[model samples]
Target chain A: MEATVKIFRFNPETDQKPHFETYTMPVESTDRVLDLLEYIKGNFDGTLSFRRSCAHGICGSDAMRINGRNYLACKALVKDVGLKIKVEPVLGLKVIKDLIVDMDPFFEHFRSVMPYFVNDEPPPAKERLQTIEERERFDDTTKCILCACCTTSCPSFWANQEYLGPAAMVNAHRFIFDSRDRAAAERLRILNDQFGVFRCHTIFNCTIACPREIEITQAIGELKNAISTGALE
Target chain B: MMQTRVVPQRGFNLDYIMFIFTRVSGLSIVLLALVGIILAMVMGARTQMDLGTLMRWTFFPNPNHVVNSDIPDVTLGWANAYWSTMQFLLIFFAFTHAANGLRMIVEDYVNRGVGQLLVRGFFFLLWLFMLITAIFVVLSS
Candidate 1:
């Protein structure tokens, strides 16, 4: 299959603004989008910069805006690009190069929520005993790989840049709902702010864009309910 | 280096307080509107005043009377009562009701980027102005 990809190009230190450059490639039907990008970088233009570690979606290093929607480049097939592809850096983020964005702020939000299990009590000799039901509490949220496909797609994060964002909220939910985790109250307390869970307008874009298929909006709704429930109690 | 932390709980009491206030104010507006409608119906348009003029008087104190009486009696008649009731309904609901409503709209129209921001911004400003005006009138009265 033949495809024309209009990729965004920019170097912040050199260029005043980002611009698009097109590359036409003859690709195989079963070839992934990342393969076409590699072909372009090697055969056509070496300046085309993007991040890709694993050829599969597990690494999550090659997330980019492919035809007005964010997706993992490694998983996206050339056939998925349609007639023409207009690729750009993820929205609501500072683009560093062709398809790379400065992930500092994105990870900063992850750090801000302290996305980890926090139990006040000391660990027992073995470990906290748990049934299947207890383990299922955070199973859905444990799928996030920090790829930032969900957060950049969120409109609430676009409006309020300081918003804890959906990815972080999902992480917080993972820890908050854990049976072994004893920081539900503290997590609720942290997410009760104006730019926290309440700021989420319940737009399902995050959930839809998630490569992990995590139900982000539902998680945020649960967190909002938790905050109010905690406040009342 | 020592780590600094800020929790949403620290500043969240105010949001909760505001949420409660907004709910109370919203309910009060509805109740007041209902009362004004009942008052208008029961009292009838006895005074030789139009609806708009009457509404102004209910919200704004009547400047016409300058009686040297000891106790100044404030009477809210039909026209004044209904207009003020409508104004209160508009002001109180505009902020709390409309702001939340637009948040819903933003959630609905996700793909339209600049258009959504522009419309939401306009609604937000309108709500802010109406809330301020409503507060001013209520305090003055």
Candidate 2:
């Protein structure tokens, strides 16, 4: 199959504005978008820039807006991307070059939520073992990979760059519900800020855009309830 | 499943009341303001038209022409301010209320996982987006 990949191209330091560069490549239907990109970079154009660690979608390095919606290029099939595929860096992010975006803000928001466990209480000498039932409470939350596909797909982030975004909050949720972790109050206080959990509109776009298929809105709902009811207190 | 307490219920009573009030008040005020503006335009037109034409419409009820001492000049300043304030209030309340409602929806749905993390993060960003947009428009205007 032949595909026209119209990728957004620009170097912020040099180019005043971004322009689209289309490359027509003959590809097989079974080929993934990453495969095509690799082919282009290796054979046609070496200037093209993108990130990809695990081609199986575990490492979400190749996330971009493929033909509008956000997805992992490595996971998306080239034949599936319509005739004219427009690949651009995720929305509400600064495009450093071709398909790369500055992930500093994304990481900042992640860190702002205090993603690590904060247990002040004395630890049990033995393993702070939790019952299977207790472990199940936060079971769903531990699936996060810090991939920004969901955040970039969100329209809210498109409008406001300051939001803590969902990924950080979800990470916080993982620890918030853990029986061994006793920082629910602190985490809740942090998530209670203006740009925290309250900003989510539950549009479900993030959930849909998520490659891991994690139920994001539900976790956020739990967090919101926890914050509003002063559960953390 | 672990025996975790259910989320604290924020009943629909307050939400329903606010929704109804905003919808009713906003619609009424906007409509009334439009009517007032139109009436003022018509009155202005009548005053500017030829005396004969003005009299034709003004005298439809065989109105008493004793340029009354009891009549007060109608100034729309207070009305305009009142109406505009009402409109702004309704919009402000409605927008925030709706935003909160959607936030609640998010809390009710997204489960913890990569999907949850990415989605909630995305939602937070979106909230920030709307908030900033609202602020910018409010401030610049």
Point to the candidate with the largest DockQ.
Answer: 1
Model 1's TM-score against the true structure: 0.71
Q: What is the TM-score of each candidate's chain B when compared with the real chain B?
A: 0.43, 0.33
Task: Please write out the lDDT profile of model 1 over residues B13-75, one tens digit for every residue.
Answer: 645555555567777766665655455445542343456644543333232221223324424
TM-score to true structure, per model? 0.71, 0.65
lDDT string, candidate 2, A1-233, tens digits: 68888888888778899998888989888788888889889988898889889888887788988989888998888667766778888888888898999999999998887778776778888878788988888788788887798888776676667777888888989888887776677777777665677667688888988888889888888887776564521
TM-score of chain A of 1: 0.95
Kindly provide the TM-score of model 2 when superposed on the true structure, using C-alpha atoms.
0.65
Q: What is the per-residue lDDT of model 1 for residues A92-119, given as tens digits with 9 covering 90 to 100?
A: 8888787899899899988878798787
- Scored against the true structure, residue B84 in model 1 reaches a CA lDDT of 50
Best by lDDT: 1
* TM-score for chain A in each prediction: 0.95, 0.94
The model with the greatest TM-score is 1
